[model samples]
Target: MERILREPLETYSTQKTQKFVGNPLANKLRGEYQRLLEEILPDRNRYLVVGSPGKGNWASCPWIAILDSLITDTAQSGYYPVLIFKEDMTGVYLSLNQGVTRVKEYYKRNAKNVLRVIAQDYRAKIEIDNEDLTEIDLASRNNNAKLYEAGNIIAKYYPADNLPTTTELIQDVRRFLNLYEELIFNDTQIDETKNLTALEKKQYRLHFRIERNSNIANKVKQHKGYKCEGCKFTFSSMYGSLGKEFIEAHHLIPISTLNLGNVQVNIETDFAVLCSNCHSMIHRLDDPSNLELLQKIIKDNLT
Candidate 1:
């Protein structure tokens, strides 16, 4: 999982812009954040949009985007995404503290080599301008100062007591974000294709006549007095419509073996009611007549 970078609320520049330009950047950010949230959250499930309601000073939009992205990304990756929102001061502090702790724990578990790889990956993207030396240095210092101040404020609320180191935190975040990307883009397609192929095979092999099979199974159960001829496993309607243990009807001659002219006769003679295990074992052989071979093997194994 790659860690997503958390943009400071000031990044929206809403406070400065709201006074000067009259352009509602904060409200716009909030709306976009909510829309992104709707895309991620599960359908027909209630979720609380937790924040200081109507407090538009520090945009809560970034936090919402992070939560939505995390949830959707995790789900898309075939993993359950659990998002806990902090509505109050206590919850916010606790969650931040927990996040910090988790990040550290994650780093501790991973190897030093892995950490180095992660740092390299992150460092590669960091851009530093050297064109205007004095101005660039000043800008860099200011940015660092801002970041430090922001970190302090976050720590004030969260209180990073026994929290993970900065290095660990960075690594964890990188891993989380990476995983999210993989799930959202790569793994999702592979999973969908795999599922579709499996469904098609199932449909093709079983002919997907579920109702017909169920009816036939029921009739076979009644005909066989609800007893497996091979294993004597008895089933009744109390357990299911088919039986308590329900026998499977196996084709002595496979459906695939049917000729055009003999289709009707083939369907009629193709089935036998056997226990589930027995039915499976019957199909283990290349040909149904090779049940004799299975019987021999079983007798030999038993002896």
Candidate 2:
């Protein structure tokens, strides 16, 4: 069985890997890899074997890549949890492939260095555009050595005793991607309207009101009541009936897309009500803090 597993990586030449996609031995090797991954991963549905032995460009080594579906619908655009085995070395690592390359161009031109930080977090090797997938090869070693080393690094973040079920891991990865997008692509924009009146052109603009539907705000007040979703500040309780319907509505959608012509906003999912103070603090940062984060801050402060 070990020999079968090693055959695709060790015995096969580069040409063989490219041409042996349908070969019986190659299929068996690929199947075994999937079986082993199934034992380690809980939600088989969350991942797909997008790349396998004997199914890559001629210059690339034999590898199996398990993709996180939440990050990308296809392997062509997202990163993957990859197990790469080459004659000189092997290691399980994260490979940001063509899909990620595309994202680097379109969504985050400034984020070229973010993946390096993620790799450092895992202590996992990084590979950008090299089809050879050889950047992870640290020294001359066997396939099992590489797998063991990679497994240890993965186990550090996801231990065997408390393995993150595939679903949990996918969610974690999604959050990581969100934070990455937030940190790397966060752009601070200032209103640049020209010919402001003397008062409007003041050095410090005290506030800017983003347009929102008053009906939606009223519905939230009706359904959820006028309690701050973050710190649970109730206006009526604090300030009598005058404050009953005074909670501010914050749109949860990305600020960049809020005014797009065809953009749709679902009140329940897209808005949160907050007390005056919390609302001000949420927008204090260049990017408004999400309600969950604000709630965490409140909880943390009390505890």
Candidate 3:
């Protein structure tokens, strides 16, 4: 797997001890900083800045403002810029690719310097040590690098100079943001329940089990009024508003384990509901008969 580059401040907590300047001066400084960043960093691809407010300080607010201004200015200059403000380093970085060239140019110009910082801090470098350099080369050649390489190809094939106007840049950024938001937030899990076909969706709903593995596991704690028949452990989706904790439905007989005649059976009746722990235990045994053993264990432990 290709290793991701990490920033210096990412690992160690750097003290941003600079006193908050007055609003006007702070704005001026922010503009200058952003301009310098534009000069040093690539104009392509969006930027993600991980910032902290730091012990009763409001510096992050100004920092975010600076980022917003930078993105706005880049948009006006006919370049797409997506600025993501991460509250901490642990969260997944959110970024939107505005225009092809914008991201390509950004990475091409900034990757080395960025990698240098990452290397200095992490004491590591991105090296292709794979035995199959040919495979790696072929992957790179085939545009398999997804975000980075694909953007470069698009930039090379269709330069930003062809973009023409600020309006076009804004429109491009907006469209990219919309698609990105949909993929990240709305298209996840049960939200996708609506998009599935009638049969597929019915199966999904019926067999939808909220295991500890589920993305919305935290939300499922509230709906545990229904106890798992296998383990006798109660479950609910009452934690968050999403109500994810309810009974998790699972296939008692694996889809693959089904007999030829039962292949066409309804999924709802074919599945069994189990609590999170019981569901895990069921899968842990890997044998269908283990469900009975799991039930016995649960009965012995609880009683």
Give stretches of model 1 more than 4 Å off.
Answer: 1-212, 235-245, 259-262, 265-268
Segments in model 2 whose C-alpha atoms lie over 4 Å from true places: 1-5, 14-21, 29-32, 54-59, 87-135, 138-303
lDDT of 1 at 288: 47
**Ranked by TM-score, top first:** 2, 1, 3
Every candidate's lDDT: 0.34, 0.47, 0.34
* Backbone clash count, each prediction separately: 15, 2, 25
- The lDDT ranking, best first, is 2, 3, 1
Per-residue lDDT of candidate 2, residues 133-227 (tens digit): 32344243543333323322221132223444555545544443333223222221334544434443231121222213344566666766677
Clashes of 1: 15
| Leading candidate by lDDT | 2
- TM-score for each candidate, following the candidate numbering: 0.27, 0.34, 0.26
Count backbone overlaps in model 3.
Answer: 25
- What shift in Å separates residue 60 of candidate 3 from its native position after superposition? 36
Residue-level error in angstroms, candidate 3, position 77: 33
